[model samples]
Target chain A: MQLTDYEKQMLGGENGPAVARAMDLLVRYGEALGAERLVETRNVAGAFNASTPSIRSMAEDGFDRVYSELNLDSDDVVDIPHMAVPTCQLITGIDIENHALQGADPGLVDMQKDGERFFGQRGINMMCTCTPYQVGNVPVRGEHLAWMESSAVIYANSVLGARTNVEGKESTGAAGLTGRIPYWGLHLPENRLADRLIDVQVPVEDMAGWGVLGYFTGLQVEEAQPALNGISATPTLWELKHFGAAAASSGGVEIYHIPGVTPEAPTLEAAFGGNPMPDPIVFGERERVATWERLQSAEDRSVDFIMLGCPHNSIEQMSRVAELLEGRKVHADVALWVHTPRALAEVSKRSGYTDIIREAGGVVMSDTCPAISRRLPKGVRVIATDSAKQAHYLPAIAGVDGWFGSLEHCIDAAITGKWRGGP
Target chain B: MPDGQSTSKIVMRGRGVVPGKARAEALVTRQTISGWGGINEREGSVIELRHELRGQSFAGKVLVFPGAKGSSGWSAYFHMCRLNGTAPAAMIFTRMTTKMALGAVVTRVPAITDLDGDPFEMIETGDLVEVDADEGIVTITKHET
Candidate 1:
């Protein structure tokens, strides 16, 4: 672990006590990861699982405690995505319903308070929600960066070709404070090249298809980065967003590529950086079905809940759901809710998208999702979701039957209040 | 300690997340735990439905898994375990995710990742194990052995 003159000076307390402390942590993180040098990050995003009200209250408390304990001041705030002050008006009603903190899990609320207070005291803006790309922190195609969220890191690395490491929370906060990260792993241009080629001949449409494709790729490569040879045009940032989110949700990877979308791979050969292409895995219709089959549990019983928006739902996704249930109503017996960032929720409200969903009896909430709040609604016997990542873990954590499938299946369950298995 | 502990030297490889030492019973999970609401905040036990080791305590166990599944707040769940006095003795992961890594660092637990052998298979739910993260080795002694 070598440090530059500036880094050494900072470590020596030359850059004020606050910065010096942050730098110390970053240096330790860098050493832990075996990084040789440090690099500058242009922008940073905030958080992925937002907290609920009870959780928010707890966060505020935690902030106050950490504030007094550390005697920290306001000048140390970091300019990042989710931490920014609420730029958009927020609408909160039923969105926090199905989460782990339904009636306010006291411990969870306290933890949330701890997080909120920590960031608040540190002068970090607490804009609640995931999908920081909607607000800001949009890394240009091919920029070097460091971010915390799995979806964000994968999207930046795979679609934008921006280099990054899936560094965790503390490191992200530490990096944001100093605006520097270790220049190793994906940050290096040479490390971004594709080691495996994933050829997908199956139809790539619906968001679920892309998500399934990601699962397939992740399962095949395990943790290695792969280049997708056959695919439709480079997906929009939104589509790539879901793909990356679902992919990283299921597997451990920082980058993947479509022949044209990623900057590193303007062409197939270019994506390889002129290196030899690894053997290709032909992923066809059978492979898609097999992937789906592999994920299905085949144990279907009436489910009490269904959840969506793992990385938090994008505005467009919310709009689509709103349109689908324009005048219809959700299953009265089953609980159905949508999750969105506070900023996006404001936009949806102004646009009347919130009203449309609300009028249909489906509530939309902002600032927190189920996974973070840890507050599931009362009497949830079984839970089903459109996200494999959610389906994979929710059952184990929530103590219920975790069913998997696409939006249609989830909506059907939401409509009938019964798990009809998969289509 | 039991006399002549049934310890076996099984070489496993995993990318190291944090560098330290930890030893305890092996608690391997193929079913990834949900980031939120998965573990009891106070009890540090698996409460999630369908989890292989549901109702089991993580305390003093050498937790093994593939990687973190969802939520960037994944570290917070483990942090709660630390607060509840049920933190794992150590951890071995086949892959490293930012959430899992943060949990390891925040919890100040020893962890070794990128294992050469499939820990999900080599380790069982209740095998005594010692994780020497400094040497990147997981020594497991099966209960029945």
Candidate 2:
């Protein structure tokens, strides 16, 4: 890969060991992806860190070694003083703030807190979330970013019109330290053109319908760029969030285009980039129902846990949840958890949505979700969630049966502790 | 079981992403494997509930699949496989994607992709596969039943 003089200088160890090591990893990673040259970014939209059992084990080796191995993929221990670009930590392996609520061991909680402190000392914002855009890290249209988290990547690319690939933890770390990424894939405008055209014949009025559409579309065009048409109504931000999250979870779609809805797709012709649109794949109600049926795993109605957010709920979504549970209470047999960004949690608290949720016996959590943390109340036999992404993952990650539905259906399940069929 | 002489070696060519050589039994699947929580890091087993090879362990085998699915966090989980000493002996992706590329890099195994022929049609589970990443050739010796 071609590198600038400054990059070469860094590669030559002129700028110090940490930057040099980070540059080396970036160059190799670019080469691995067949990227020709590195691109510079002025507005780096922060990064999401990946925490695993192996990464957690690095505590014994100390923070320097941990940073070196996890981020730089180097064995050499080097001190990283600060990120070259602004950075924020992503959802971790366990909920550090409320481990007891998740039924986690004390040692696991200590490990998470220690990791947080180490990252915080290095200038990484500790607002761990998949939806960093909700927490004031919003990137503008056409901005270049190095972000991880599948949902965030799709949202940045499709909704925000920012350019970013679904970056891995290592590459994002390198970008945080070097403010550079390989200029290939979704970073290039030519690759962003829609290859598959999807016509939404089904009426997608709610978040669940949009999720089903996205799930169906993603399965149809696996790894291919898709553009949607024939959608009469404009979707809300929350609906788009569900659409992108579900599509990205079920398929390998890094970017998508919704004509007149998402930025860069002002019209169907523009979404196709002057090329002839491919034959449209019809997403009808039958397909949507089938997709929804596939997500349901529970044979019985009993639900032990009800989780509200997957990509971390926005403040608006939290407000809606609060409104739904206003005068109700979560069933004694059900443990209802509402996941959101820490910043949004603060806003929800100020708005009294947190108190309302608390009064209803639901815990409003931040910095983590069951999908990333891989934690749930012990012996949770069945789980209900409004997120298609969460429903697709919880069975495998948490070893529980899943019931996927709308927010109202999930709230109803939380109240009655029973999933009385579909909404 | 058939005699050793009955086993025939078939050589297929592809591009090598990581440089190494290993011969192991193959665990093939057409479904793309999810990166996050898809595999058990400790045991190196496919834990994706609906995956065809659900309970099968990929440890010490050649993992043949259509490439990675879901999150970019895929590399981190596979990286843990390396640290835990439970990674597959080698990997063969039918189609290369960014996530799978990073996974191959972090796993540091003999990995190949963009084959001359479809690897899914050519390889099967239990086949003794030898990967020469340096030469970009995979020698498959089918198990004689």
Candidate 3:
């Protein structure tokens, strides 16, 4: 890989040992991808938090050790410098204030707080949500970003028309320090176009429908860009967010085109960028039903927990949840927790969404989700969630069988403590 | 040394991203493996509910699959597997994505890709295999001719 003069200087240890180590990791990672050069990136989001119990020993050593080893994949224990570019922390493992509710160890929570302070001092914005675009750092069309979190990467590339591959922890860490990522894969213009198309035969009018479509699309084309046709409804940020997150969860899809809906694809013909499109895979009623059924692993109707707002919720979603929950209490046997971005959680507080949900015996949370934290309600053997990404992961990560359905279904389950929703 | 064993050895070539060698039983799967929500790092087992290798630990085996799929947390999970001593002895994957490449690098395992021949067709789980990633070669010793 050809490094610029400034990159060479950094790799040669002119800036500091940390920058040099960061550059070194970039070189190896770039070469592994067969990239010929590195591109400058001013935006980066990554998992820089040391919140997991597995990293307790390293955290005991110091946050620097955690950053050096986990982020840069280095062993040198270099003092982390201020980020060279704009950087933000993605969804962390534990919520700062709700650890007790999630049954997390207090020691781990304290370690996370320390990590945030150390890294935050180094200029990393603690956005603390997977959906950073919803919170504020919205990148414009054609902007290059180095980001981790597959769901966020897919959302940025597909909805926002920003370019980013699904970067790993080490790669994002390196990019945050060096402002460079490999100019390969999705970073290149030629690779972003759809090579195939999918025909949506069923009406995908709601967020749940979009989630099913996204999951089905992923199963049809793993890692391949595909444009969707036959969707009649105009989707809001909420629907597209769920769509992208669900797609990335089921498959490693970084970019997708909705033809008329997304920014890059103004028309079906434009979606392919002049390449010959393959036969359209049919995502009809059967496929949609199958995909929805595939997401639910629970057979027992009794629900123990209902988790919402994966990729974290937008304020509108928060309002809708609060509306459904007004004057109602969650089932005494079940727990209901609503998650949104930390910034939006504050807004929810002022908007009375938090108060409304709390009054109804549900909790409003931020900074983390059960899947990322692996911290479900204690003794949670069965769960239900509106988010397809959460449904796909929570069952596997939290050791609980889960049901996948819409917000109404989840909320109803929260009220009755039963998995009455179905495919 | 188990020298002069009656089994025939065949050496295949590929692009070796990480440099090291390990001889272990092959745990082959045609399906792509997920790293984050798909596996238990401490146990080194594929835990994705419906994955073909569900509940199977790859700790001491040469994990042969079609590279990583699902979450960008791929590398982190594999990295943790290394820390926990539950990582695959070597990784032999067909496709190389940023997730798998970074994962192989951080896990510090012997990893090879871009094979001249189809590894899935030639290798099977429980077969003795030796991965020499430093030289980009895999020697497979089948139990039956």
Native-structure RMSD, model 3: 1.4
Query: Best-fitting candidate, measured by DockQ?
Result: 3
Candidate 2's C-alpha runs over 4 A off are: A42-56, B1-4
- Candidate 1 chain A weakest lDDT stretch, 10 residues: A84-93
Per-residue alpha-carbon lDDT of model 1 for B1-145, expressed as tens digits?
Answer: 4689654666665556677888788878886654544567566677655467778887888888775654454665676566558788888776554556567766668988777877877888778787888888777777774
Candidate 1 clashes: the total is: 31
* Deviation of model 1 at B1, angstroms: 9.8
Q: In order, what DockQ does each candidate have?
A: 0.33, 0.72, 0.81
lDDT-best of 1 and 2: 2
Q: How much lDDT does each candidate structure score?
A: 0.65, 0.84, 0.90
Single out the weakest 10-residue window by summed lDDT for candidate 2 chain B. Answer: B1-10
RMSD of each: 5.5, 2.0, 1.4
Name the better of 2 and 3 by TM-score. Answer: 3
lDDT of 3 by residue, B41-129 (tens): 99999999889999999998999999899999999999999989999999999877889889998999999999999999999898899
Candidate 3 segments exceeding 4 Å error: B1-5
Predictions ranked by DockQ, top down? 3, 2, 1
Candidate that would win on TM-score? 3
- Candidate 2 is graded, for docking, as medium
